[model samples]
Target: MSFETALKTAQDDIQATLTDLLVAFDGPVGDAMRYATGGGKRLRGFLVLETSALLDVPRERALRAAAAIEAVHAYSLIHDDLPCMDDDNLRRGQPTVHRKWNEATAVLAGDALQSAAFEWLAAPLTHPDASVRAELVLTLARDAGATGMVWGQALDMAAESAEDPLTLEQITELQRLKTGRLLEWPCRAGAILGQADPVHLLRYAADIGLAFQIADDLLDVEGEAATVGKAVGKDADAGKATFVSLMGADAARDRAHALVKSAQDVLLPFGTRAATLAAVARYVVTRDK
Candidate 1:
């Protein structure tokens, strides 16, 4: 199947589980959580399914992990859109959680979603092997906590208030932690479920993850808010440093292209089995949003 078609198919699978899981909860928090997680490209979750497919992982375990990732992603976005953070008013072409509901609702929903993610990961149904489930939980905790996504976010928030702008190297390190880590996890999920060596997919993930951030930086510079489905140009307005800011647009674009090329190269060992992932890497750099 074509990349877009395959991606959509994956989205359908992930979203159904995501919706079911959230709806099982009760109260306004559950309502808010469902709303917050309702829409997006589901790219991270898609990575899990695609990687699972490539590795021949069982569908049941893969789908659970995919849903788990989507929950975490939605929580991150809800928190990221808070007034104390990016203060985004829109997401996925709809009102951000904080704007649509309230800050308290958003915060509670995000917190609950995060808790649910761990619960899902810890569930025995995700994998028959207890060790595998434990590993997923432990690794996710590391990547999503102070050591990874949160670390990057703290750096970003600090940069906003600092007297001096962050250097290019600093920005790169920040993005790697904030965005790249979670993206990498979905790829690793494939190997985790299939019980295969993950070295190559991990490398492929690193390159594409960086490319993904670079592309986001580019979108901030070149895309329309309507098209991007969120407020665009905020980075520039806030005087934040990004790939485009550090390298110049031309250089940044070239860098993203080069990263995508290397990403494809890393998957050579998997050959055609890696085609979907390779397409995802290219799409990361090329997507308008």
Candidate 2:
């Protein structure tokens, strides 16, 4: 199958599992959860499933992590669109959770989804070995908690009012935590499940994660709102520094290309089995959304 076909298949697979997780709960919170997760590229979840495939893990087991990561991703987007945060009214070309329901419902839905991610990770179905499940749980806490995504968000908020704009290194570090950490988890999670060394995937994740953000920054600068989803130029509107702002547009694009190369190179350990992942790394730099 082609890469696009494989990606679509993975997206469909994870969404079905995600729907099952949500439909069991009924209410506005459930509605909000479903709404928040309905669209987008399902890129994070795809990373999990594809990595698991390369590692020779069964899709049945990998599907659990893929669903869980997407739940966490949905929760993050809901919160990120909250009034106190980015205050976005639109997400994926539709009303954001807070706009569709209310702030309270959005908050509750995000909380529920975040909690559900851990619940999914802890489930025996994700892995028969208690130790592997525990590792996923522990690493997820570190990546999504105060030290990771939250840390990046906090830094971003702080920079808005600061006298000096963030330096390139600072912004990169912030994005690595805010965006890179979550990206890191799924790639590494596959190896953790396979009982194989996760070190190489970590390298791949690190490169692709940064490239992903840089590509996003490029989109913000060059993409139309209709195509990009959400509003374009949000970072620039907020007067926040970005890779494009710091490194210049041409240079930022170059950096993302370079990172894609690094990402593909790291997967050499997996040889031909990793071709799809290498394709994904390239797609990360090219996707308009």
What is the overall TM-score of model 2 with all chains considered together? 0.98
State TM-scores per candidate: 0.98, 0.98
Across residues 134-217, which tens digit of lDDT does each residue of candidate 1 receive? 988888888889999999999988998999999989998999999998999998888888898889889988999999999999
The parts of candidate 2 lying over 4 Å away from their true place are none
Report each candidate's C-alpha RMSD, comma-separated, in the order given. 0.9, 0.8
Model 1 ranges with Cα > 4 A deviation = none
Residues 46-139, model 2: lDDT tens digits: 9999889987899988999988888888999999999999999888999899898999999999999999999989999999999999999998
Q: Local distance difference test, per candidate?
A: 0.90, 0.91
What is the lDDT, from 0 to 100, of the residue 13 in candidate 2? 91
Which pairs of residues collide in model 1? Answer: none
